[model samples]
Target: MGISKPSRRGFQICCGVTVILLIILATVFTILAFTVFKPKEPEITVYPQGLENITFGFEGFLNATANATIAMIVGINNRNYGSFKFKNTTGFINYRGDVVAEVPIQQSFVPARGKVNISTYANFMVDRLISNTTFWADVLAGSVNFTSVTTVRGKATVFKILKLHASVPSICDISIFIKSQSIETSCKTKLKL
Candidate 1:
């Protein structure tokens, strides 16, 4: 078929417009894919805990039989634009390089750009610690020092595009004064989420 000059020009124009529109759509899709698939980790903070609220009881005045219960609180800050689904969190209280108490975290969910408070209890017996020499020395000094390690496991989900898993650990020092019924604590938590 013999083509007219104006018809040929119109066909060229339509081809050029279609090619430009296709390139624009491809670029927009690429940008959106990168933005939606980026990964981020959640953050956790353990409050400086003074164990004053921890209850201590002894079965025998001179015996090594002691029972204790502790209340611990922590704050989780979710900075990402997603929800965090935390798994079973646990905290271990260590004294003289031994675990004295085990705490289970109560709360589980952290919303996007939100903060949450989690409370846990550690109740344990001192049967193994009674016969220890350093334990009595620390008790006689009227102050006993302890360490707590907490671990949190979770996954962050965003817009059905990204899901990143994270593990967070925290450490804190605890001191209890027998005579004053008081407690002092220092916490340094570097979350590697």
Candidate 2:
């Protein structure tokens, strides 16, 4: 008796149908990967920063423990089609190589394709700002430059459903001309998951 080849296949999906199914699955997977797993970066810009209510220290050391409130203007742009919900965010202000001030970004939800502005402020000591040799030299030279950095650690929701977690770092360079009361700002952002 010969094994009747076991009817190689009873009922099977047609080759064309199988190919179509495979294509559909592949397309769906690709879309999901790009939208759910891919990391998206939001754009950030720091407007001009101003030194307000600045007061130098007491008698002997004027620059020591200077009391001053610094105000920094920040703008965030969410370009993704999904909303970004950030929490426990923080901002850092650095002069030369040292962090002169820090602030916490209020927990909020950034809508998709939306922009939001924030005015961040922190009290920093001129003693710390002048601590950096470069900053000190610049101060003596009459030109001061600082950096404003804002970081948002949160999850991105695509189509209001898929949530992927990541951290977004936004940095801006600040040039302050104390003599002229002029300020210049430029910014850049990076996304890291």
Candidate 3:
């Protein structure tokens, strides 16, 4: 059997219409991806009330060491059009490039164009600080300095079609004042997609 001329013409017309519609849909998606659905770096902020339950001890009034729990409230602002779902991670507290403590971050999600605050605490040991030669000098100055790094890894889903892996890392410098029981902190955050 042979195909008829009218049926062939109708099939061609349908194919042409389907192709045109597909091209239009592709263009619209491309434009939206470049403008509205674009990814943005998340903002991270660390509050000032940093450390708590501080305790110091001296061995025979000569050897001094300290232990404390670092309590911090971290805020995350998502500026993207999609939600971020992050996994559980660990944050590090470093003194002179040596890690002294670890903070556990629970898995969480941030809505599109929304904000979330997380409270995390970790026990800090002063062994590395005391081992440093400048420890006593800093103690005499009544302030101690430390650095903390926290990285959140997640996936961003857009329109249930596009999924991109993202990593947001926040670094902070902290200074603890012994007498005043206060903390000074400065932070910087970056996002990688």
Tell me the deviation in Å of residue 92 in model 1: 1.2
Candidate 2 stretches with Cα past 4 Å from truth are 1-19, 28-39, 55-64, 131-133, 140-142
lDDT of 1 by residue, 82-101 (tens): 77787886788888888887
Best by TM-score: 2
Evaluation by lDDT, superior candidate among 2 and 3: 3
Q: Estimate candidate 3's RMSD in Å.
A: 3.9
Residue 71 accuracy (lDDT) in model 1? 62
Comparison by TM-score, 2 against 3, better one: 2
Candidate 1 TM-score to native = 0.61
Error of 2 at 3 (Å): 18
Q: What is candidate 3's TM-score against the reference?
A: 0.73
Q: Is candidate 1 or candidate 3 better by TM-score?
A: 3
Between prediction 1 and prediction 2, which has the larger lDDT? 2
- Count of clashing pairs, candidate 1: 0
Count of backbone clashes, every candidate in sequence? 0, 0, 0
lDDT of 3 by residue, 1-193 (tens): 8889999999999999999999999999999988887677788776645567888888986878788886767788989888889999998988878888778889999988999999888768866667878778987899988898998899987666778898888998988898898788787878788
**Number of the predicted model whose lDDT against the real structure is largest:** 3
- For all predictions, the C-alpha RMSD in Å is 6.0, 4.4, 3.9
